[model samples]
Structure formats: structure tokens, C-alpha cells
Target: MTAPLWGAVPLQADEWRFGLWAPSAADVALRLDGTLHPMTRGPDGAWQVSCPARANLPYMFRVDGTDYPDPASRLQVDGPEGPSLTVDPSQFDWGSHWQGRPFEEAVIFELHIGTFTTEGTFEAATHRLADLAAMGVTVIELMPVSQFSGARGWGYDGVLIRAPQPDYGSPDAMRTFVRTAQELGMAVLLDLVMNHFGPFGNLLPAYVPEMFSDRATPWGAAIDFARPQVQAFFHEAAMGWLHDYRLDGFRFDAVHQIRDGRDQKVMRDLARDLRASAPDRPLHLICEDERNLPSLRENGYDAEWNDDWHNALHVALTGEHQGYYSRFANAPFDHLARAMARGQVDEGQPSPEEPRGAPSAHLPWTAFINSNLTHDQVGNRAHGERLISLVGETPARVIHAALLLMPFVPMLFMGEEEGSTAPFHFFCDPPDDDSCEAVRKGRRAELAGIGYEVDGMLDPCGEAAFDVSRPYPAEDADRAAAWRDLTRRLIDLRMAHIVPLLRSGKIGDGTVSRPTARSFDAAWRFEGGTLRVCLALGTPLGAVEGTPIFTMGDLARDAFALHVEITS
Candidate 1:
């Protein structure tokens, strides 16, 4: 493993070096396994102490009398408030071989580790990977596993950016999870948060306050990425995760909030460095940037979460236009058509909600990862209602089939394919401080502002929120099996038809035409042939001319059909 700028690094069998960066502190000391040792301070406020390599030894840095956990900690044996533990990442055996699959062939399944299984540990989650693989999920995107305060969280509010949450088992267990997925011919993509650190257990502001700019994000203070130290800090974390655990890639959370003023942006640097780190392996870098900047794809991003597609589809299917969904409320079908053909709905279009995005028609369809539902769409709601609850089973099933056959890459939230109706509430367990109350009030206000009735909303900080949010596959075993069967068949069809067209990576900008008010025909030309999809909601679809791949509902009723026409 490459030695990180900070954290516990093992050099030799008998030598373990611990380092901390605290330029603001007058003095810094390393307390290793209950033993206090004075560290040597260098010219750059970098303090280092070389001790005997002791794995699992509890350690913390005492900066000017107060003890603080390592910001780059790999494992917090007793949560974020406690001392960090020393770990040798090379200790885990990866077993045989796994090189990972290409991003084009990806069928992403986004799962939150804490709620994905009853055990909520990496070990437990690893056991269920084969099930997902069998369902034709090629990529498993784990929501952030970074250690936060307390136990339960969406992982966006992670404090220790490098450490794996103690609730999710050891660092080696996470490694084993990745290896297990790879063995099943599946890649693991971690949702990484580098925009801002969580409110609790963060020691950066306590010591190095200059790391943050005066500007603040909705979550917290904006990280000052212009500073060389800050850039290197995030870089080390990204590279460390890539090398230490052999993770295939990362889906950077809310990169639109990553305000980097410098030409050498930290996000771009992260992608470049990670790509260079693993030239042989297909390392996918996806981002959730609301800006819809085409430059992200031009730079190094494999794909951007197509919120336009989801928003338009949601507004059409459910007719709930609150907050961001309001942007697509007017002419929802038109927005859906644009998203289906051009990859983005608000492509340089006038919108009062947000600034217009660049034209994305030139982008390959695979560059847009489209999904009907995601964690944000479900969890951000006051009650966290799944699509099935909002729009009924038939409409949801029709849309789900269309999502799989679309030219864009497809993603499924956990239990989405299984048609699980369990709500994915925005859950977190922070300290019982002002932050807890702030979270409660903030959520209430946000939901109220979005036109949701917030009085009966579930308390995000309560244990009940997390408990009821878990997807229960056993609750309706037969129905879930049917949903799984349908999903597997759709995925199997996608693999045999759509994936082959996408593999060439040479696809033309698609065309869209409204056959009826609620029905639209969209098609994209690839090297092999043209992939066509006609989705009709409460309207009859016109006769389609091609080899039928999949069809749902009757032609004279609400329906969705996908076809492939080979060019002579």
C-alpha cells in the first residue's frame, strides 16, 4: 500500500509510523495503546512517531492538550469519538483473480449497507451479493461506508472519511466484501463523500480551521480546495481506498457542491490519479452533479446521475411536483422525451429553479445513468414512499421495464426489482447535541418547504426511522420472487440485446417523437442497429416495426415496448 500523508503506516515488521497534520497546534503527541509518546514535529506542521508495528492498537493524537482521532483513520474500534486503530491493509487475502467489468456493461444496484440486510455488516451484505449477481447486477454501488458518529446513517454525514464504520464490521471485512463481489464477476463502486465532512466527530475545524473556506454548503462549511494540503488530503483518501480495498470505482456524492476555484480541481485530479493508478482495470468514476456540466464527461467522469430523467418520469408517473420536481412539472412528457433522446431535459432551457445546463446531445447514451427511483427520490420525501405506493404496481412495472431497455445505463435501488414497498427514510444517528435537534428541525423545514405535510413525518434521528426503512424480502416472499423473476428476465434481455449495442461505444444521438399526448417513440442508432422504445401511459401505442425484445401491456392500452431494427 502507498504510504498516506497521514494515518498509521506500517513500514517493516517491527516498524509502524504514525503521522498527524496540525499546523495550528503548538504541540502534538501520539498516544499509542495507552502509552504516550512525543512525536517529532517537522517544518510543515507534520508530526511523526515511529513505534513497533502493533495491529489493532488504539491510537490518538493529542494536539495542544486535547486528544483527537486521526482524520485519515482506517478503523475506529470504538466509533468516531474513540481512538483510531492501527491496521495493515495487506493482511486481507484477495484470493484468485478478478479484473472487473467495463462500465458500459454495468447494471448498477445501489444498496445501503446498514439497511440492506438485517445484520447490517459487510459480512452479511457480502453473503447477499451472489443473489444480486444472479439477478444480472454487474455493479454493486454501496452507499458511503465512512464512519460517522453513533451507528445508523445514510453515510453522507461521515466524519472519519477513511475509516470504515465500526457497525459495518472491520476494514478487512469490507475488503472481503469487495473480493466476494469480484469473484461473482461483479464490481463494487463506493459512494464517496468528499464535498464536506459531517457535523459530528470532525476534528479538522477544531484544529485546522483554515481547511474550510468562508462559504458553507447546505450540510456544512465548504472545503477550501485551493490549498495544496486540502487537495492532497482528499487525494490520499481516494487513492488509499482504491489501493487498500481494491474498490473498482467511486460515485462522488453531490459534486455540484464541490466548489473548487482552482484550475487544478480536486475532483478532476482524483479521477486522473485514480485512473492512472489502475490502467489495467476498468475504474468507473460517476458523479451526482446537478449542474449537468458536459465538461464532467469530457474530463474523466464515466457518467452523471441523470436527474432529469428521473424527475421527469416521476412528475409524469406520480404527478408530485414539489421542490426540484417542479422544474419538470410543466410539459412533463416533453421533458421525458428530451431526456430519452438527448440525455438531459433542461439542456440550455430556461428554468427558474436552477441555471440551464449545457447541450448533452453529443454524449453517448451510456454517459447518462438513468433510473426511475433512487435513494434521494425515495428518502428525501416526508414519508419515503416507493413508486409502487405512489403509482400502483402496473404502471411501476411498465416504467421499470422501459428503464432496463433504454439506451442509457440502468441502476436499481435495493428491493426495487423485488418490488419491495419498504420505505427508505432519511435516517441518521448523531450525538444527542444541538446537531440532533438541528437535524430534526432542518428536515421538518425542508419537507414543509417542498409541500410535504411534515407534521407526521418520521424523525430522521429516531431509531424507528432506520428500523422501518429496511427492505423486507421475506414479508411477501412469493410476490418478491415474481418481481425478481421479471427483473432477471429484463436484465437477461438487456444483456443479450442492449449491452451488445452499447459495447461498441459508438452511438448516435437518439430521436424522439410524440405519437400521442401520453405516448412517445424514442430510438438511438448504434453500430449494430437501432434500439427503439415506445412508452404509452393511458394511451394506445402505434404499431412498431422491428424484432420485439420485450413488451408490456396491450397495444390498445397503457403499454411499453422495446424493439431492435437491424440496418442492412
Candidate 2:
């Protein structure tokens, strides 16, 4: 096994130079545009070839006299098994934009294009760009648009890495989606899964068996990043998205499952290469890892979705301690208090479940608090209970306000802003029985630990899950207005004061004090020169108590202490 070529520049541009370590193959040829370009075998057991004028040419690879698709093709027109297309990055007309927002300042909005709107297409989703921009969202993080087996999917099961899903419209539609978002001053973040491919319609194995490693993940053995050829495959895949699609950043899904026993981490190598390749462009790497934060920081990721904050906040607000929320039931307010101020909750203590030493001491984490309406939380549940259903509207609104006010980068799932009454059920459209069975078994096994029955959850093969997850349009004008007002005010507060104070590290000790009788209700108060207080009244009460009186006694003589409720 050869060591990874860290930050190695490609041989040349336009002329595609390809290399793969395949000692087992007797012969190798680079197939492009119905032509075979014979690859020369190097002394290191690595096959190399450079095809002249290969830009914008459709191509594939043949190993040991048998044809196979390029595992790391830049443009896959059909499925992963289909012929590869060499797309010229310069062909697209980027209208008057060359820069993206810094990772720290970005307010990311994660959305599934198929479910975000009534029309499940990129062009239709583009129409909502103004709404996202109006909500102060700086980045629209799309859950993988890559072509899968069928019409509808969550995108994690995508087999075609390069091609945009045809159901979500064509390649032009995706380009328009990005262009529209860019025109609206919002950078586009694409979610990429380098860890593993779905079972359905994947043709990668037909070409290179080494693509799937001997190592195992929860899903299955993923692409072998430690292997020399596998490393090259993934590196090129990462660069391809940046160069071909012009994606601003990538949200690596389930990166913890990317098994590599090599000395150099594949993620670190990818990050290093991406930075070296496009030093000017903003390339944010966000991971969804349940492990300690040190791995993410040391591996050079911009941010990791801080689920610890979410878990703690969920338990605090709803008192639902099932599944993984069990570990955070007795967690002190100081955990959340510190996270609000410092961006991490498990900074010091060892996780109750994981045997890891302890989480990273301090790291900036995107805080997702008190919002249980996310796909993972809702769909994974037995009954698919929405947040409003589990916790009443009053408590839900209070929790939502607290989440927005929290110091870390806040993200709202689709329909979450308006108190979306609709449930986000787990959905997929697998083409075959084998793929469908794999999905059903996988989801069932994952939920079994939480005491949820497989039969209870929506089947990935069924059309019910896909249909149930769709958003319900706002019927009541009052509810719609309330949601709009709440979001606008929260966003304004974040921009005006909370973010600045958090950045400066000036916001000191704060507490969400709640009346003993009404524990679900709470008030957040910041202690400083100018006292800022935000109260959430969950229940209708004649009188509410608790006020912090300073020694200065700045209150006016005639001014009596009164509860102030700001409702639109």
C-alpha cells in the first residue's frame, strides 16, 4: 500500500492524467469518447495515462481487459455504472461573482430540494431563494442532489456522484439553482457522502473492486481511503465537485464511518488538497460526527454539527430522554450555558456512553438547540410526532425562541420557522428489491436500539414515507404571520447583538430561570452593564415572578415591575 500523495497537483489541465495502483490487472486502458487510450504501467505498480484534449469528453476506464466506470469521474451523465462525461469547468458563465462567505459568518440553511417545495425540482426550489435570503440565510446547504436509482430519495442513497438527479430537474436546473442562490448573495453548500455508496444502481464495483475496502462501517464497507488507488479516487472526487459544479463547500455526511487505518487521515488530505487547489475560494468542510471534537479540529474541518448541544437542549425543554437523549437527562444548565458562551457542551467531561477520553476542550460548533423537528428526530420516532405534537405550541415556541437566541450558529430545518405542522417522515425510492431490503433492514436495526419497531416506521420502499414528509402550506394567516414575525425578530436580534457579543466573548454568565410551578416556561437574562432579558411564557398566567435587581437601582420612581410580552 503506497502512502497518500498529500497536496499533489494533477499532472496537467485539459489533458487528464490518470493513475491507479492495480498490481492485479494485466492491462489497463483509459476509455473516453468511444476510444481506448492505453495506460502505461509504472515500476510502483501504478497505472498512468494522460489523454490529450480530454476536456468535456465523455469517458470511463477498463482494468485487466474488462471495462469499468471511473470511480472518480468528474461528470457522470447517468448512474455510477454509466459512461463518464468530462465537463469543462470554464464552460459555465459565472456572472460577476468570484468570492464566498467565511465559514464563521455563514448562516447555513439545510434543505432537501424534493421536499422543500410542492414541486420537487431544482427550478422550483430556486423560486424560494428570495425567502431564504429574507430569512438571513447566507448559505443554502442542499442535501445531495446526485442522481439515485429512482425519482425521490433523501439523497444519501445516491449512486451517481456527478450527475444531478433527473427528477429534481436536469443538470441545467441545478446550475440555475446555484446561480439563483449566488445571485441572491447566498452561497450553495452541497452535502457529499464519500464514506459509502447506496446499494441501488451503483456501478462502481463493476470497474474497481478495490473501491470498497475490507474495513466495515455501520452501513457497510465504504471506499477504501487508505489504499493508494482508493485515495486517488476520493481526492479527485472532492476536487471534481469544486472544479466542475462550483460548489462553495461540502457537508461530509457520517464522516466517522470513513474507515482508514493509514497514517495520514483521508479527510485531512482532502482538506489540504482542496485548500491548495482553490486557495481563493471559500471551501468549508462540515462533518456529522458523534465522536470527540478533537478529531474534527485536528483533521482541519471548519465546523461539526454539535449534536451534544441539541441533545442537552432537547432534554431540558421537552424532558424526552429516550434513545441517545438518555445520556443528557441529568445534565446541568452550566453545560448549555457554557455552550452558548463557548460553543461546546462536552468540552471537558467524557461522554457517558462513548469510551473516548473526552471531547475537545474548546471548538466553535454550530449549535442546534431545542428544535426536535429535524429529519433525524422526527422520522426516527415510532409515531413520527412533530415538535408541536410532542410539546404544545406554547412550549414549542418558547424553546424555539431560546434556540434562536443561543450564541452559536443557528440552523432551522424546512417548515421549522413557521411551526410546520407536517411531519418529516423518512423517505426513499429504491429501484429494486435488494436495495429496498437493505434500506429497510438498515433503518430497522438503527431504530431497534431506541425501542422503536421496524414496522412502526415508514418503509423506504413505500410511497407513504415520501408523501408524508412533504410540507403542508400555511392555512391559517395568523399562524403564518406569527412564524414570520418570530423568525424575523430572532434573526434581527442575532445579527444586532448576540453574534457580536459571542464573537467578542463579552457575554458573561447567563441563566434561563423558570418559575418552579411552570418548569417548561423560562426567561434568559444576560448580566452586564446593559441587562438584556428574554422571557418565554409557556402558560397563560395572571402574574409571573422573578426579576434581577441591580445595586444601582436604575428603575424610575413611578415605574412598577410589570411583565412585558411582545407578541405580533
Candidate 3:
């Protein structure tokens, strides 16, 4: 037993120092290399021990005679229930001369790395970085990569916070990924889940009760961010990703679930601490807050996932209102206008999901990331339907144009730009047979009452679910090409005409009245310029006088959209 700080600390090629936060334990021991080494306790109730770290070495902390994986494990072998391994962070050489892209000039592409490429590895996904960069994507927001239990799962169930999923290769794989992405002029932001750990192999409760709180989130447990040591654990997680991984940003998952019963808000404190971690390099701290509050930006988030905007636009375009989609059921177009005019809608209004949400007053459009489709909006549905599938192709394109034309920053879910036929279903690999059965039941029950999809229709734990979730090459060549062409033109139009005016705060108050039953003539004041956006719902729009800056399809057709920079 010896004195050392928390986490796996490498001393030499073979020797390593290990520590664990086990305040509630009466005794602690390091179980590794087929031997039990007694650990010494620190003043702050941490247990420390030193041991050998080899490629074959598997280790665990035995506190009060119960063995558990290290809470702050940097790398894990086998899985979360498996042993923690020592990782050497000094070997990798990160790229140089790159700061993160600001939200003001960002076009985010959110992807599930496991399903982004055929091989589903970080190394394999690196092959497509150039393709994305060429498509005008500025930031690549990766779905979580933490070590969840089993052969395959979406990373939200991860138990090991610092370690990359073994299924996706090692830590160096991620290091190489970040370095290569930075070199390719694309910034990578990792999605991290701190609200709760997965159902299986989560060891914090055994080590100490203070690690978690009595409060619970929709997933399961809520972490005790109010506690000093617990807060430090998460703070280190943020610092490790920025300073160690050399990543551009962190997309904190479901921040609305984090409960801190204290004056020093955990999120603000964590953000300030993260900002201080790497002063030389720029880093963004984004949040996924369902509450749609503007104050979160003040708390340190660069931007938030604007579900309200999506909900409003989705109901308006598709007219399929069910489950969480019902919030915008009453007057969808009005909500859409509110979202465009103020960057948010239904502020302080009571709804099914939340009791009351804070008004998003004076929030810059850039502060809200607008998109027609997101992981939750598409994947969390009962059947995991894509936006294009939910609505007709023409309506989807019109909505896409409307989404990109908004003053807010734009994002695309994986395969959305290419219009791939594959669906991103809510799929996960459960650890055991009973657990798998439980998962299927839970998933069915969740959607059953909502009337999105009836029970026993889709199984989240099935391999078929993952099979359908994988992104493939775009379906039909000519249709794919047309969609691709439309995407390029819309992005070009946005970057050239709309984005500049938006950043300058010239794109002001906008309105959308039902011009016809199947058409909308929407226009936003561009200060000194006039920009008219017509989403005809495949309904014919009349010819414009000046050369229209951008048109998705023939101006005579109503389904396609037409965007004209009114110069008169």
C-alpha cells in the first residue's frame, strides 16, 4: 500500500499506482495479477495502492471484500464488468495549430460512430472525415463512446466514464481520430452521459452512497453532483477529455436530469473548470437540455439541442402528432413562427414533458442548434422512423430548406444529408437473457401508452434492430444525387446569404400564415434586404422577377421550395 492520487497512474513500464474513492468502506484492497494488495487510506477517505500494469494484467478494487471495477478507470478490458487496465497517455502526439470552430460558424453533423461506417470502429470512421468536410460539415458530434457492457450498445449505458468502448478499439484509436479530424478541418465533439450510469456494471453505489443521490432520472439513477468528491470525479472526466484526449468539445447528455442541491451550480462550476483546463486551445461545452432554457447558455453551454424548433416544424410539416410530438399539436405553424422569430417557442408554457420551461429571451439564434431531425427525434420513436419516411420526400425537402434558412445554427443527423434508407433505431445489447427480456418489455411499455407504436412490434435488444440502425450508401443514385445537389445548394445559399445576415443580426422577426391549404409564403425582415422563403408543399409558386438566389426544384412546382433574395 502507498500514497497516490485517484485513477490509474503509470509510474514505469510495468509499475503503476492505483486509487479509488471508497469513503463508505471499512476496508479496501487492490485485486489484480492474481494477488490481493492491501490499500492505504488517505485523509479524504480515498484508498490508494500500487501494482504491476502489464498487457495481460486485469485489476479491480476490493472494498469491504466486494470487488468492483475502478470508478475512474482510464481503460477497460473485456467490458465494464471486466478489469480496468493501465493506459499510457504520453505516447500519442496530438495535432497542432487548431482551435475549435465557434458556434457562429458551425454546421454540426451528429453521428453514431458504431453505425456511421461499415466496420463501426473509430479507425474506420476516419475514412469518411474527408467526405463530411467536403459536404460543408464544420463539426462532427459523435454519439457517446464510453464503455458500456456487452458486444454492442448505444454508449449512454456506459459505466466506465474515461475509457473508450472496447468494441470500438482502444484509447489511442480515439486519439488518432481526434488528431486526424482536426487535421481535416473538422472539430469533433464527444457526447458524454453524466446524469446516470448504465444498469449493469455500475460500481459507484457499492463504493459509496454519496456518489449518487436519492433523485432519479428517466434512465435510472441521478449522480450526486452536489458532493465535493463526486463533483471532482465528473470535473476530472471533463478535464481528461479536453486536456488528455485533445478533443474540441463535449456535448453533455440530458443536463436537465442532473440535480445539484447546492448554491454552486455543478454545471457552471464544471464549465468554468473545463474552460480553465486548456487555456491555449478553444473548447466548447454544449448541453442537451430538454427544458429549453436560455440561462443554460449563461451557465456555460455554447449551444443547446433545440427540440422545440424541431417539434414545431415536425408537426407543421408532417401533421403526425403523437407522444412527445403532441406538444406542438394545437397550433404547429404558430410555434414554428415563434421559434423562427425568437429562437424558441412555448417558453414558460406548461406541457406534457415538463411543468414549465424558462423563457428563451434574447437568446441568439446561434445559441440554438436547429435541425429537422435529431437522434432523439428519430431514434426514440417506436419504429425509429426517419424524417423523410415520416413525411413525403417533397415535404421533407421543404422542411429541410426551412430548417436551414432559420437564423439558428443547423445540424444533421447521420445519413440525413445523403438521404440514406437506413434507420437509426433505438438499439442496445443487453448483458444477460433476463435483462434483455426486461429491456424489450420496458421499451414496448414506454411507447405503448404514448400510441407511437404498439407493444411487441419492435425489439430494441434484437440484432435486427441494430441491423436496421446502420447507415448505408444512399439508396437510388439519381434521387440521391438530386438530394445531394439540393443539400449543397441549400448549404451554399445559407452560408452565402442567410448565415451572414443572421450573424449580423439582420434576420429579424418572421411570420408564417397559411398562404394556401398546402403552401406557405414566409418572409423574414433582413434589415436592408428582403428574403422570401416559399415552402409550397409541392404546390406551384409563381415566377419571381429577379434571378432567384436559390431554388430547390422548378419554381412552378408546389412540393419543392424556392428562396429568393428580394433585391427590389
Name the top lDDT candidate: 1
lDDT of 1 by residue, 1-568 (tens): 2455588889988789888777778988999888888998778777888988678889989989988888888898787877888988887889986788988789999999999999999999999989999999999999999999888999998989999998999888899999999999999999999999988878789877868998968877899888766777888889889989999999999888777786437787788889999998899899998888888788888999999999999898778899998888988988898888799987776776666788988988888999989999999999998888898888888888888888789999998988999998999887886778989999999899889998788889999899888887466788899999999999998888888888765566788888888888778888877777777865777776666667877655445443333341
Question: How large is the C-alpha RMSD of every model relative to the true structure?
Answer: 1.9, 5.8, 3.2
Ranking by lDDT: 1, 3, 2
lDDT of 2 by residue, 370-394 (tens): 2334667776776566777766676
TM-score, cand. 2: 0.82
lDDT of 2: 0.64
The residue-level lDDT of candidate 3 at 540 comes to 61
Each model's TM-score, in the order given? 0.96, 0.82, 0.91
lDDT of each: 0.85, 0.64, 0.76
Kindly report which residue stretches of model 1 are placed more than 4 angstroms away from their true locations once superposed. 1-3, 352-354, 559-568
Top-TM-score structure, candidate number: 1
Candidate 1 global TM-score:
0.96
Q: Judged by lDDT relative to the true structure, which candidate is superior, 2 or 3?
A: 3
Query: Relative to the unseen true structure, what is the C-alpha lDDT of residue 378 in candidate 3, on a scale of 0 to 100?
Result: 80
